[model samples]
Target: MNKQAPQNSVRLPERMRHLAVDSRGYPVIATINRSPEKVDFGSISERRKLALGTFDWCAVCGMPFADELRWQMVFEEGALPAALSGEAPVHEVCALYAAQVCPFLFSPRSRLSDEGRKGEVRESVVRFVGFESTSAVIPHASELQPGIHTLAFEQRGHADEFSYSSPDELGERFADALAREKPLPVSDAEAVLVRLFNRLDDEGEGDVVTGAALAAGAVFAKDIFKVQGLGAFQGKSYPTAAALLLKGTEEQILKFSHDSQDEAFSAIGPWVLERAGRFPLALQRWRTRGNSMVKNLGPSSPQGPGRSVAKNAPCPCGSKRKARRCHPAGVQATP
Candidate 1:
């Protein structure tokens, strides 16, 4: 491992700042090994790979994933059948930083140090596929060695391909991609807004709120807050303003979920009253329901073990049912 302090040339993402640095001054990802004597960036740790499923940790920062959507980099020929990926899930920022700094990703001609690894030396493309959930973990079919596991996503989201000659150029491309996101259809946006508001009304100013509604509301409020000053939905009615907010929110959710679901959930009332210009009664209902909802959801926890494990595959917990029906009902297996 590199004893020298990390180079300041690359501004790593906040989550990656605490990672172990290699001799090249690059922060080693959680899936890579960093011992006292050496930092092996070429190989992934099997123990950590398993932990990805067991603990629902990000592959890059090794932290538990929260409300943010899961992301994974896919090379030209690296995608597996049924939307499964050998690479573990990571945060969007982590994936973007890795693409900017990793030689194999940013430099098209750069080859992996280990030629024996899967998809070695092929033309590289920084393609990030997003997902709503980490669906499953099964033995890696592509790995010659045993005990290697692969992760699967339940539902894939929008994907973008980035091409650039330099890291700065790549950053520009990322920004451009976000800017190019098409607005959600007006009808769809109105429906989402009306539905959420109606749910809040139906629940009344009481202390209880549904989990699904709370989750959706948090996502809605957060996205609306983000696009607030972007010069959208100005001088509109409460329903129209909220619908426009939903439109912007849907666009954002299509890209990635909120970073803090709790914060977003809490902000619903403030956003409605201040931004959407809603009445006091609406704000009161939001506060009452949002507060109760947060208490019920508790603090954010690991999103897995997912409920999409293959019925014919061995349980992730090392069980061997005859028909491999250990996860028949998609219940979490003990890790």
Candidate 2:
């Protein structure tokens, strides 16, 4: 599925990544990025190349790219380990694994060439350096404008000002409004998730969701996607929060529970593709995977939001009978 960019900016020459697992329980084929030009739904190709392996980094332990067998296996096709695939993006299964298995994955480097380290720091440390380009993005959890959202941030000095909405207009303003400064060096993004969760939990006003759990949920969701042949839905569609919750199993849902905390999320990634049902792109993939990638992830798995749950055998309502058998009266044959 292919979606158009924001109305303000022209579509960037982006790549499409289709992440999935093969037969073995390893994080292979992180994703397959299709050409942005491919827009048609039914005409899109089913087979494409893959990007495999977790992008793990560690200060003490180096990457294990030395083993030829591992290198070969990295590109190989297979299923992600059950633990890794619990509830994250299908493509990020390898990235989460890299955080655990590889010492050099996604970790900050203390020592480096000035330019190299600076570049790395810039990415990890995002200062709210004002708006680069204001365009509305589909509100993730907030109930607001659906059109282009502003892409404003704090100055270079503070990286913590990255907000989903325009912070300037909000009543709560930053200390030095529009200040420019370097952002703090962050080791792992999991901390961001932790902070988000903590803040939500602290509000104590509503359903509190932790940052770590969210990140882990995203990670785990992706894993489930890989196993379920739903990798094509990752970024192609814009799904709503409710729609995003449709993919995964009872165990995966438990993994992202509020109480799971940092420990459970230590090996998880963000489940950005949860909204596959909210948009047209993801919806198309949901329909295609049932026939194309069913062998790898299984059609029974909950891979999309709008998917007919009743068609999935063994109804969630606890009928103790296949959905089709118990509700054959409602099942409609596809012409």
Best by lDDT: 1
Off by over 4 Å in 2: 1-129, 132-193, 196-335
Question: What shift in Å separates residue 62 of candidate 1 from its native position after superposition?
Answer: 1.2
- Model 1 over residues 163-270: C-alpha lDDT tens digits? 444456666644543444332222332233323322212222111112222222322222222221212222332233223233333333332223324332333333
Candidate 2 lDDT, tens digit per residue, 1-335?
11221211211111111112222222122122222232221121111100011111110111111111111012113332211111112111222223222222222331222332443431232111111111111112211223312111111111112221221232223222213112222234333322332221232211122222222222222232232222433442213222223343434444344334444233232322332332222223333433332232212434221345545566544666766556644433211
TM-score of 1: 0.44
Each prediction's TM-score versus the true structure? 0.44, 0.18
Q: What is the C-alpha RMSD of each candidate to the true structure, in Å?
A: 21.9, 21.9
Which clashing pairs does model 1 show? none
